[model samples]
Target: MKTNRHSLMAKGIMVLLSLLILIFIITFAWFTPPEERNDAHGVSMKTKAGSDFEYAIGFKTSQTFGEYLVTDFTNSEDSEWDIEDLHVPGKMKDDQITPVSYNLLYDYQPIDITGDGYTLIRPAMDYGNWKINTGSFDYSIAEANTQYISFDLILRSKAATTLSLGPNSYAIGASEVEGTTAKPDGSKLTGADVERKSDYGNFSRDAIVGAVRVAFLGFDDTLTAESYSTGTQDDKLNHTPSLLWVPRPDLYLNNNGNDLSTSGWSLNTGVTSGTTFNLQSQAMNDAAYSTYRHQYYNVFEMTNPNDTVEVATDNSDYVHVSAKDTEGNEYHLNDSVELISLDKPMTVQENNEDVTYYYGKVRVRIWVEGTDSESRRALSKGKFKFSFDLTTNG
Candidate 1:
């Protein structure tokens, strides 16, 4: 009787195990179903010279049942397409369940530009003998099974000024090279082009790697103190120190060529129209009052009872006068004056009011120097409006 009880107990245990396994299988089928997958697509485009190009991607899914989750597309580190798997669950004959995966191949329209989505991908340069390439960021998407889904992409070039580096002409593959150098065998050298693909969006794969080297660096005029010579002066004065001087006139004569003893002018001949004078200086650190001479013409303007004076000098707006050594090499003077007028003055029988005038900016060009006077010495083009301060010689 005990043996009979053992056999019956063993049969009951087997039945229980089979029931459990059947239940597990049914539960899994109800919760998670297989999804239809999409086929991979390829990318190719033809662009115009100096122009931007675009392409698009399109996808479709099978009819799905229950709730469907359509996620963003993701990209591989090197490819340019979005891919995802579909899943479905529940009864298929009733509305509770639906067909999962469908056809693998579909139409993918070219975006107006490059890359994925409606975003633009710009070329780095013009379309010439060179090539252009750029990379996009990685992205991803998730979708539910047993549902029909679609992906649409619009590509175009970025706005102007967006393409300023790297290749700007041809589309290159992994085997192609970029850069301005050549291989030892005299062939051309190039750089790489890689972008990530995902549903989340896009990002740059790496920094741009190559560009041609330009020859001339920008010139800083303020930092340059230079001068060229006439046959009278040396070819040009570089950062020379001996040219520093502050110029001022020491003598003045009247229209008759008679020396005027006073430092200013007192006019009677129609308000002495020539009493006003202009002072100008050269750019140089070592300029002195002794190194230069002055020549000027004085004129007067009369308005009824008041006389206005104006002075004219040799220094014009465009002329730059510099100093030179015995050899004629032009040098920068800390200061040099183009004498307009001197201490001598014209006798005026009437209107003697003094008025000061001002003109033009003071520009200087200097060099790096260590000597006391030579240090920071600049040769400059200087102009001044005469301050006609007339203290009535009571």
Candidate 2:
């Protein structure tokens, strides 16, 4: 009789355990949205970040000839950056700045002719250019809220080296990288939507990536004072300091389907008419290399503007495709691109160092090109990565 009772008690315990497991499964399934599910249906975006925009500078794990670093203006010995894991990259606190893990900052709002999206603004540079006066505290390194996102990097080489900078293609979740399907007029996609297996969305744009420009500003001769220059062949690149443009080709808008998504003027050359709204075609590759400076566009309007843009003089509801840089330099954003520098010097800092290897600082400025035809309000949701490759040009 005791044995039978013991068996009955064991059975009861098993039943309780099973019930608890079932409850957990039901609760999880009921509360979790498809987008947040752990399954591979919608969540694995092949990126370390989940924000509207994700970025990284990666090199193959096999290449270890020289030392490469992503660091900030911190005085700590461990100032080296961890790019693969999403870490707080110069998060701006009213009182202090520290590296912590957090949600990434989204795109700037109300994009206009006078907005931050219009040009390559460099507020940070090596030798402590990014440091600012806190008033209450000593000068501290800070990042702009909307103006731009800059990264500090150091690359080491024995001598002058020419690096190969290439871009990666993008793809939606479990979808082919055919291309984006959303039209420039902020309309829904037609051939790449995951739900319909056709119609790709605005989450990624090809021309958007092409319009991005990265320049190796030059090498640094100082490490504690303010300095900036667009030096000639004497300064294309070399040891201790440089500037680069980290491209976010997969950048998307936060509120894509809202009324605001359909309200902006499509980039220049979009299919539009006087005060009448129409959807733009799939894409317009307005990212052409400027043999001669494309005069900054001047938007023309016929009273109420629609989802179209054109040069001034003609009576149409469109905008001219030109903007002023941070320094009041007028040039179309599409025309303001510079390729990465070649054979820059490298910097080295060791108490008893050898002349074989050298190190240099590189400041990467990442932002969306505001004048690209794909910069419409509707195409907002995408992920892309960067490939930083360097090889001798011998």
Candidate 3:
């Protein structure tokens, strides 16, 4: 009877061991495999399965100006001119001067006056046998004859070679010359007594004479004097002037034997199994993209391509990357990032057989941070290329 009790006890122990094993197997099979992670230089990539197959994606960038064209203006005349004949004063026609057009929506003052002053003045009287003392004469008497002309320029959007001066934009000087010439009685003829005679007539004697100077103002805060002969005028105003409105960066994704559509850089992948994608960017020209402090953010969204059903819509799904300067220091998304790299590798898994296909979009946003006054005025404008490598492992 004792031998029979021992056998029954052994059978019960065996049954308990079998139930434990079955439970363990069922629990392991119910849950999916844990994701694998890899990191390099502070950048991390996660995937459900190891990447075995890889393919490179090539991206080419082409820059195109907005509806308006950025142009440079040049003055055909010299900086100074000699007005020999008063009848025909040295005239700088509107055609000779280039005008700026307003295509952007920002308020722009093309020309700024920096300084105004007379450099030299010489007065003479055209009276016969009327000897008068030069130093004794009142110079203020000729002030009425001296008139300054100014142009009221306007900015308009039209296809033309040159700019046109607005209506009633020009101010004409005094037509009649007014000044005192020596009289036979050794007296002075003043003011209205002067006639509208010849250029140097007795009525116009002692008329103000001097050289008037004008120049293009510097756009920068220094307010430097820019001249035409030295080519500083064109350098300051025409070449690569600060843009008032800069457009956003253009991004594109090219896959195997597929190109981007006119609609944008949106990509639609037909892969059912999980996939991995690699990202890289191309540097743009200095003229096109100028930024003192640059920053970037990578946004993503997952949805059903056919049904427009949303899948991953939270901020957790998005990843942030940064650009490095000449030094090896890393910049945050909120800081300037001149040279950027992939923040992290992305991994997508199949939730259901019916939802085999994953439709998603990757968007990149770039901006400039203003740390100082100079950097605040700095703008970012350009077209850059980004390459991708998509690998699929089922």
Candidate 4:
């Protein structure tokens, strides 16, 4: 009877494993699998003239888009993916992005007029330059939601290795030419101007550069690399899929671009060159900047804040991770994660270049963590040129 019971338990575990694998396969099938990324030097890919645009993204109608891959993400159209691998390891866009994006988010004035060497990052709101009294954070700025950048893509691994991602060779700067024809005296607002606009769609990459987060939907954060991939289908389905990220690169002041920098930022900001006024009070209001204290709204605690480092929005109260838990609560694993799928290896041939790789559907997100310390101080109008490096230890 004991042997029979043991046999029963073994069978149960096997069935469970089988179910998990089935679900994993279905999940990938539900979402398109990773395929070849191609280029045509400006020649139509359909024509095969070998003229692939350096890089392309978004709708086919988009001027900035290159007809690299014929898959239309937003429209859910059939991808023109062939049953071949381009035999290339991986390559990035070679040319600079033409005409980088621009915006009227900020017309920054030097804080030295009031006395200071730092900038303030306000809440996701619009407040007209409300020059408030020293140490007052509760001024006229309206409260609102913050803007962040995000995208999703499939990572085809070549081996069953542990994976980690990092921003490689990425830099963003603002433009020199400031002020728009419309708001020339130059229009700027505080909490009253643009407090966290609820519309997530309207935002600029002119955000804190370092506060980036990655989510591998195929795995669970709480579980080990082995179990997480088999954990649940809910984690994959709960969050919305983002369009493949394709940046429109360009030049700017530091880089001038159209991203909003919260208004009345100077109000709470307290980066002064002295020890005169209330240090404790400024700290309370959260604009504390002096020899004695340093705290900024944008510093989301992705890292510990001490003498030398100022991690963006280090506090979770400010950082926002959109994924939710099984109980539907916001899941806050707010950092990039290791992506481990199956060891099942496959090979493909494209343009007669055969390649071997594993499949891992990955969701990648990047944004200026508004809660980061450097966010407010970051250039408002700029271009962010980004690339990702996926490495592994099998």
Largest lDDT belongs to which candidate? 2
Model 4: per-residue Cα lDDT over 1-394, one tens digit each = 0001100000001000010000000012123322322221111111112311111121111222322122221212232222111111122244643423311111111110100011223332222322222222332221111122212233444455444432221222111112211110101111233322212122222322222222233323343322222222223421322211111111111111112432312222112224323211111222332222222343322243332222222222222222222342212122333444434345656589985655444433333322222232222322222223333445
Q: Pick the candidate with the highest TM-score.
A: 2
The lDDT ranking, best first, is 2, 4, 1, 3
- The deviation in Å at residue 143 for candidate 3 is 49
| Clashes per model (N, Cα, C within 3 A) | 95, 29, 3, 77
- For 236-316, candidate 1 gives per-residue lDDT tens digits of 222221112211111111112111211122111111112332211111111121212221111122123211111122232
Per-residue lDDT tens digits of candidate 3, residues 1-394?
0011110000001000010000000001111221321111111112222222111111111111212122221111211111111111122347756432221112111110111111111112113211111322211211101111111111111111121111111100122111211111101212335422212112212111000111111122232212211112121222221111111111112112221211212222121112323321111111112221111110112122221111121121111122222232211122211111111223323364331211111111111111111110000111111111111111
Candidate 3: pairs in clash? 294-336, 294-337, 323-339
Each model's lDDT: 0.17, 0.25, 0.16, 0.24
**TM-score per candidate:** 0.13, 0.35, 0.14, 0.31
What C-alpha lDDT does candidate 4 achieve relative to the native structure?
0.24
Please list the Cα RMSD from the true structure of every candidate, rounded to 1 decimal place.
42.9, 20.7, 42.7, 21.4
Comparing 2 with 4 on lDDT, the higher-scoring candidate is 2
